[model samples]
Target: MADIEVTSTCEEGYTVESVINGEWELVVDALSNDGPSANEVLAADYASCYIPAFRVAADKHGYDDVGNIEVDVEADLDEDDDLVSIAFDMSVEEDLGDDEQDIVELGEDICHVHSALREELHADIAIESGV
Candidate 1:
């Protein structure tokens, strides 16, 4: 059996409803005027995966209480609306000081979504201390 499975169906227009692992449901609109588009969902998934990986990386770097982290994901698209690049602006509650870059590297290494995305699509991260 496959480790991951998702079944998606579209009854009308560009909106699709998907069932993941036969338990979770997701709704995506290709145009995204009514709801989140596919690219938006992918951005969210990357952020979600990154947060925990970042926390683990912080811990491994011997810094406790990294605190609340907020990630703003931005995707650049081409004329055909194909993704060209992604960037992450992260705000954290704790100051990482000199170890920030190392922690970021470790988090990127650990995040599954980071591994899944193409090298060109890898997020250019900027972290700000406070908030």
Candidate 2:
């Protein structure tokens, strides 16, 4: 497996700048200026990753041109203030047969991000901060 690394920098405030492969930069900030909050970022990332999975699933079922699939992901914090659960509603611009909806749902399992979150896969989390 290839090792991928991204770097992020932030000041005391909410804005964060992330560099991907030392090439691309994305600025994620609090929603004050209509920027993306951390919660919003997670929702967007999951949805973005799911779209390709949906497309691939549609193709596998011998149906192309499913059109752009729109995924809406909503997440909420649990009692302990941890982001724990996500609910999604999707819409495919084109019409699929009655049974084809199941195929689309099956494709959702293909997204690694979605799968990891859904299954609550363990992660080695490390934090370094001055107290």
Candidate 3:
């Protein structure tokens, strides 16, 4: 059996509905004008995974909490609309000072999505602390 499974179906145009683990559902529209495009969903998923991974990294680095973290993901597409690059603008409610880079690195190491993405698409991250 697979460790994870997702079933996606489309009855009509660009819209697709996905059932995850047979419990949760997600809807996406490829046109994006109707709903979120596949790229947008991928960005959201990266952010969701990175946020908690960052917190866990902070904890491992000896900080109990990093406080309300936010991430703004930017994805660039080439002429063919193929994803070319990704960037992350991250902000935290607490000051991490010099330990920030280490935490970010560890977070990337911990995030499954980060590992899953192509090497060229690994995010260029900028973090703002105490914001």
Candidate 4:
């Protein structure tokens, strides 16, 4: 398992932190008193998984110029219960010739993170779109 450690500091009215061994930098609001909750962690995991999957899918379908891809993941938590549901959505800009379906299919097939999460945590996932 991969391990990460974060050290946060209050700077400019925000909690700025650097995640050790992580590629992206994160900044949180200090005044909100809400940071890096369980749902946020889940969403970050899902989003991180999607980046490589999307890149591989685009390359396999001959989309050599797959631009930046953005993924949005949401986890719904029950207020009075312990059930959690996750939803994933993504937007990718690529230059492919009549192979959009193939790219999308590849992405769906390689999204192993969601499958692993479902098995480990018995969570429900709602996939709005593959691409």
lDDT of each: 0.92, 0.65, 0.92, 0.59
Candidate 4: regions farther than 4 A off? 1-34, 80-83, 95-98, 119-131
**Candidate 2 regions off by >4 Å?**
30-34, 79-81, 118-131
In TM-score terms, candidate 4 sits at 0.56
The collision pairs in model 4 are none
List, residue by residue over 23-75, the lDDT tens digit for candidate 1.
Answer: 99999999996679999899999999999999999999997789899999999
Q: Among these predicted structures, which one has the highest TM-score?
A: 3
lDDT of 3 by residue, 29-128 (tens): 9888667999989988998999999999999989897779989999998888788989999999989999999999999999999999999988999999
Quote each prediction's TM-score: 0.94, 0.74, 0.95, 0.56
Q: Global CA lDDT of candidate 1, please?
A: 0.92
Identify the leading candidate in terms of lDDT. 1
Root-mean-square deviation (CA) per prediction: 1.2, 10.6, 1.1, 6.1
Better of 1 and 4 by TM-score: 1
Better of 3 and 4 by lDDT: 3
Error of 2 at 34 (Å): 7.5
Mind giving the per-residue lDDT tens digits that candidate 2 earns over 15-98? 888888888887888744536777677777877877787678777877766766656566776776467766666677666666
Per-residue lDDT of model 4, residues 24-112, tens digit only: 66655434354664456556876687568767887776666677676666667687533377655656665454665566567656877
Clashing pairs in 1: none
| Candidate 3 weakest lDDT stretch, 10 residues | 30-39
Candidate 1 or 2, higher TM-score?
1
